[model samples]
Target chain A: MERRAVFKSRWLPYALIAPQVLLVFTFFYWPTGAALVWAFTLEQPWGGGSAFVGFDNFAAVFGDPLYWASVGRSVFFAASATTLAMGVALLLALFTDRQLSGYRAYRFVTIWPYAVAAPAAGLAFRFIFASEAGILAFLNQISPGLWNPSMNGNQAMLTIVVCYSWKYVSYNFIFLLAGLQAIPRALVEAGAMDGAGVLRRMRDIQLPLLQPTFFFLLVINLTESFVDSFGIVDIMTGGGPAKATNLMVYKIYFDGFKGLDYSGAAAQSIVLMVLVMALTFVQFRFIERRVHYR
Target chain B: MLYRERMGRAARIALLAACGLVGTVAADAQTRTKFDLWQGLSGDLGERVNDVCKRFNESQTEFEIVCTSQGSYDAAVQNAIAAYRAKKQPTIVQVFDAGTLDLMLSGAFVPARQLMEENGYKVDWANYFPGISNYYATSKGVLLSFPFNSSTAMFYWNKDAFAKIGETAAPKTWEDVEVAAKKMKAAGMECPLAIDFDTWQWMEQFHAIHNLPIATRDNGYSGLDAELTINKTKFVDFVKYLKRAHVEGWAKIKTRATGATLGEAFASGDCQMTQFSIAGHGTIVKTSKPGMNWDVAMMPVYAGTERHNSLVGGASLWVLQGKSKDEYRGAAAFLAFIAKPESEEYWSTVTGYIPVTKTGFAAMQAKGFYDKPTYKGRELAIQSLTASEVGPLTRGVRLGGFLQIRKEVTDALEAIFSDKMTVEQGLAQAVERSNATLRRFEKTYAGKTLP
Candidate 1:
């Protein structure tokens, strides 16, 4: 049965949600509006002046090769990090769902990492995977000059991707575990009575039922991997070693804030916002068709 | 009835005392001309800046400065710019070296010389060190801000490690450093030298001391029409040399990506030598391993290159516009106070930043401050800063959009060092990008000439 709370007055529901409505308008809509305006305008760093140059900022941004490179890196990072994090989380959730020994402890331990902040996680992983005098130092001893991320572009990209996935794995696990538990036990028991092995039961029943959850996590992971990786990228690579990790978000910050090219930065941000939106739309339009929602 | 009357009397007495306290607070606020000083340092350095304000407040009674830290240099400049837009700016803000040119062209400051003169302070503008002061000065040598927390790069080397390679002192030339690094490498040393990726040390300092122009038109001091000439210069050769050194297994990069800082690496005795700021002396003293013997020398140039003055690296105090006359007086007084010889000595003793004036250095020398083991080798920074007369090209860069330009150069270094691009290709592409930034900057402030 669908439940609904009836309001006594027309203004009651509006009053109840006014705070949230105000928050969204203030923090989200206002900034997005301002960025839209600033995208077509040139702002002086020291104030006192501005000029509107329609689409000049956008044209400059689109013409920049470095900007395009950052865009490509961002897309690659988004797909790689999302798949890696979600895959690891699904594996963890499956093992724990099997009711192994100390499953409760494993569940509790898994959620602890989600509490660790992104920058803190970035710093922790930065030291652990450090090329020299760190936990991975023994690799360099085996083959001298083999493990330095500072000099290697691909390795630098891998370092940030791994650190990004490590933080997000814990987050994805909690949701996947809940989705797995939401399934009816009787269906799985019937499949087991029919002599279906564990893997077969999961593939035929559990995974098919987990589609809605999978779609939900996919949207969040993909969208979040676009913008939320700023802290990790900043702390880990600062978009460096030849700008390998210079994602679009970090570039917007570096250009807009540090470089004080507010117009250029605002334009880059517009491009990033459009990219995230297009990604979400594509996922819903294409990927959601095959998702069987119960 | 009697108890109620007594309570009323007691309340009246308490209210009278509160009124009296408020009166005194109002009077104190009115008598002193209060102004805000937004500094861009924190932690130990921030404490020292606050302590300087405290000393100034104690030294006089006419005015008060409310000191606050914006946490970092970039934040301070950003906040100040934003505040200026809102017409809520502080009277005095600490702007970093890179921001000097940007602030200069913004036309938002009262020239330091004119402010002092109008405030009745007898400032010998020539007393400021040429190397330190020129960065914040106009094309004709008029200061636009007061040099605060000045420092320059020096070659830091481990004497103990160099002893293992039979070299007793720091290298004075690129050739000497190469020989020492190769010998250290031959002696089974894992990492002989570590260089960070900051363009300040590797590019600006390298070019400044070798009497080379980083850009045209006296590095943008003359006008706004200057373009980057870095690619056509010897920097390509320099990058190639560094690349070769890295390939030959003698030089190791100790940047943030490496999970170690250049200072920490040298301090921990892992890297034998590095070129970093003299201000890093404080960190080296605190973080160096036990019983490690190390010293610093002026950054080495090529063997045949005649040494010129290296540019300043830290920050300076810019008196922002739109402040009242009374606040200007207070700012001038504080500037004069910090410019004192004794104040310079105290500041350097506590913060490892070398004094920015010749008289300050002389006073420290006369007081035998440099004779102490803790303070030894710091005077070399002052010597390096004043190695020769300030030439047209050696007066420090005054280009617009310098922060972005520096990033381009660093990106070039990264690309070249990572083998993603050849030296000429990387530097040429960087120059092209940097020139575009300059063009945009020039367009932003169209028709405005350099001050």
Candidate 2:
């Protein structure tokens, strides 16, 4: 049976909810509405005098090959970062759940990376991968031309991906661990008694029950990798070694903030917003059907 | 006894209140007009800017200038623009060479000449170096921004590193530089030369010194519709040479992503030779170890062509519009102060940049400023910048979308160095993409012709 509290006075409920409604309208809907309007116009670089250009900015953005290249890179980056973060988080969560030696320390340390800001973590990664003085500089010591991210586009991309994933792993770990703890111990034990090994127990009993959590984390991580990778990209490679690491989000930041092309940036942002909305829609519409929520 | 104690307490309270009132009134009377000056210099140069502001503040009681460092040049421009939109802009803003066109077109600036004249200060515009003035002046030969901390690209070499190869003279041309690099490589120097990520030093300075037009219509000085002629110029050959030098392990390219700068590489003796702004001289002096000897020379040129002057590389101070008359007067007073001969001498001595005024140079010369060991090679920068009569190409490129155009050039060079694209392909792509950006910028202005 469902329980509900019916307000005796309708005005009381409306009064209580007014602040949140006001906040949502002010912060979210207002900016979104403004961006929607700007998406169709040509804004003067400074201020005042914007003309309605009707999709000209969009046409220009879509026409650029570099923009398309950045889009492809963004997709690859988000997918890879999501998979790596989730896989590592799940593995660590499982191992720590066993309460092995120093499990408390492991638990604390696993979630500590989330406390670091993205740009700071990116800076740390830059130091770690520096050409001559990094810990990985030993790679270059052994082979003179082997591991220079300064000149190698592939290495630069990998560096950014690693930096991005490292920050997200802690976020993924918390949710996965909570989901693991929520799994019935008796159910896992029954699977274990049936001669199903640890992997088998995890696969047959816990994994299916964790599906909803996994899907939620998937959407969150994918959205974050798309929208939140700018700091890492900015501090790590600045979207270059030849625009090889120019993710879509960084491109937006670069074009809007650095290039000062507000209308173009606004149009690109609208496209990105629609793309993410469609992605979230697909996840809810199709993928969520397979997720087992208790 | 009770009445006497109450009276004493009342007397004490009255005394405290009287003191407070007097203090408040005196403070109000002595308060100076606070002028905010935002610049983009850091390290020693940043400190020098602060010191200059302090001197101005100390020299007068009318206005107190508070100088704020805005980290980098790009950040300074972006922050100033944002602040202007919010109507909270500083009275004076320092914008670099590339940003001049943007600030000029923004119409948010009060011409420095107009401000000085309005405030009844007679600024001797002719006293400024023509190369410096030519870069910041309007097409009608009006000074829009006050030239400050100006520098130009020139050759810098490690004397000790050159000594190891029995070379006592700086290379006068690119061929000599190549020869020296080979010798330095033979001597087992890991990096014979390091190049910065700034394509301005390579394309603009190189093309200007070679007397070749970087773009059509007199290097974009004639009109805004100018297209880049960089790919057709001999810069392609220079870039190809640099690429070959990289492949041979004799050159290093310092991307902004890299934790190290070209200045650091050269100052630390990791690289023996480079062509960079003389402003980097301050950093070299601050960071170099006791025995690391270095000197500046005229920038290397191509084999047979006669060399011209290099263009100015540093920033200038622009007076923002939409300020109170008092604020404009204060800003004008500050400009007039920095332009003084003594102030210029102090700035040139501290920052290693060229003095902006003729009187300043003459003052430094009279003081034997160039005779000092630390300033031994700095005169070469002045010579390199003012080597020729200020020509249209040498005045500087005033392209509307210059910041984006510069990024395109850097990205292309990076592509070439990384072997992702051939030199020809990379430069051609840069030209095409930059032209598109130019078109977009043109559309933004609608019908206004570039001055």
Candidate 3:
């Protein structure tokens, strides 16, 4: 009788969830499947039907050095941005979790950058980094022979990395702060009673407790870094100084929208989607097991 | 039951009255054929268009013309295509020059010549400039679209910067330009010369000025099977000059996407000189504040090659298919009204676009409008654009998928500027890639050919 009652309750909830399930399938899954099909065909809007080319588009994508170069740059940007954002957010969250004065103000200020749109942040970075009359240029005017990324590729990439980190660190910090706040205070007190130092308490208790949040953050930050660099690269250098900063999404945009190579761009997009999905799956399968949830 | 019957009777009476009102409205709607116009011009130009449209709407009782701004040229084309697919396309759309081939191939445009003839409007196609009309017209010399807001390239310079560099006249040739650039650099200016450097301006005008083929078969006007021929010595020399300018700090290359306004940049003395469209003259004048000295000049020519005139750059109005007869008449009338002498004069004076009709230019000239010092050397640009023979290369590029090909050219140029590839290598790659694009376009648009 209890099993029957439980089954009946579940059925009601499942019935309640049916609409959302159908919505997702119709909107997301259906379009994604169609795009996957489109990736293999030569399709034009008013032209005749698309034909199956059997990996020809994919082969073209793989053969192009520019595509691979963009992939490499995207990986570099994502890795650098994700690492910097996670590290800075962790530090800021630790600092804000303390019983220090004006912590609220610091927290508010730290989280403020998150409120700005990604494109607006890119524009701000461009103004700050512009060579002719940027803030950095003004600073260089006073110092003479300071860092100028406008004419240098490595320095330009560094500037992009720094800008990406600046824009996203606040978001990670917000998540980390919330994660830290959720941990019981007694755990830290118990560690203190056991004669653990601040670093030990953080490393052993706090980090372990925040592992689940950290994993979620790690995935989110990686995706954000991979995807959001498109706007930054477009607004900042437009993959300039010899394509130093052309990320995958930006390349897709250029090929698809700007260059009007719809098939080529769709193929590139499929590859990118597969790569991201594989990475995300690996993160979930292998990395999630290591994330402890106390 | 008696109360329910009474309520039903009252509801029936209300429904009958509503039907009668709707019947009148439907009759009114049937009497007036409404035509939708999608355009990209905004600000003052858009307002002028609206004023003209308002006059047209008031001048007729059988048709109503509604105009809408659809953001940029590219956006307008995209929206038109999407709407075309949905069978809800507008009656008329203003497409940029780059979008011409795409529209021509789409087979959705109702040729303006046919529309005008069918609607009983008199169109003297011969009165239009041959060089300009040939670009937007069919091979049989029929106008496919109304030529509106046509412009050619012009050089703009800061007089103050020129004085500072000890130069009193505009550069007349590429060699002269190089010399002036060096002088400007010596005078402590960072960017002696800057150009928008768009693919259309740099490559297209390069071919135009040098009388070199940008593509085979008269830039694809003969057929769809044309290939790119822009990898010759003339283009190579041009790129080498640009590279030398970059290396020596005589010129600064900025992306067309991110570059500030040429006029504002020149006025502020950020750049000593710039090459841009004549259509920007109005903005140049407006942005040049009090005591700021700036002047217009003809585009510099290559020293050795035969100097051919530049082609038009702005958009033309295309009439779309699937409009009612009355709406077509209204569109033709609106076109004729805008093409009238007084209207063209007012438009040219307000905006910097050239008058489409000869009478309009004569009217402006009769008023001694060019005598104003502020308008100094403005006629030189027009005269230069009208100079010499309309050579095969200088006529205008009409290659299918020209827009995409231009982007590839821009990519190649950017690669060269960023030192990823040498000018020769970039040009070679650009030619190869552009040929591939042209081949694809030919395959797709097989039977389409210019008359």
Cα lDDT tens digits, model 2, B223-311, are: 77888888999999999999898898888876445556788778778888888888877778878868888888998998897878789
Native A-B contact fraction in model 1: 0.61
Better of 1 and 2 by DockQ: 1
**Which pairs of residues clash in candidate 1, taking residues 3 or more apart in a chain or in different chains?**
none
- Cα deviation of B187, candidate 2, in Å: 3.0
DockQ scores of all models, one per candidate: 0.49, 0.45, 0.19
Superposed model 3: Cα runs more than 4 Å off: A4-18, A46-54, A139-151, B1-32, B41-62, B139-141, B164-167, B187-190, B254-261, B324-326, B372-378, B400-404, B446-451
User: Ten-residue segment with the worst summed lDDT in candidate 3 chain A?
Assistant: A1-10
Q: Which candidate leads in DockQ?
A: 1
Model 3 C-alpha lDDT per residue in residues B1-451, reported as the tens digit of each score:
2354466567559868996877965565567778898987765666566666767776667777888877467677778877876788888898888778777766788888888888787877777766677778764556789988788888888788888878788888889999988987887888888864477667787778777888888887777888998887487888888888988889875442333545557766678888887877877777776687878887787887567777878899998877677778888878878888887776776677887666666777888877876555556656766676666666688886676677667667777876778888988887887787777555444455545
The positional error of residue A184 in candidate 3, measured at the CA in angstroms, is 1.0
**Model 3 complex DockQ against the native:** 0.19
Q: What residue runs in model 1 are displaced by over 4 Å at the alpha carbon?
A: A1-18, B1-33
Question: Which residue runs does candidate 2 get wrong by more than 4 Å?
Answer: A1-12, A189-196, B1-30, B42-47, B256-259
lDDT by residue for model 1 (A23-132), tens: 99999999999899889987778864678889999999999977788899999999999999999999999999999999999999999887988878888878887888
Q: Residue by residue across B1-451, what tens digits does model 1's lDDT show?
A: 2354465467559868886877865565567889999999976788789889979987888999988889789899999998998899999999998777778878888999889999999988888999988888889988889999999999999999898977777898888988999999999997888986799999988889998889999999998888998888777778777888899989998976676889989999999999999999988988899999999999988988899999888999999999999999999999999999999999999998999888989999999999998889999999999999999988899887888899888888888887889999999998999999988887777767888
Error of 3 at A166 (Å): 3.4
Model 2 vs. true fold: TM? 0.92
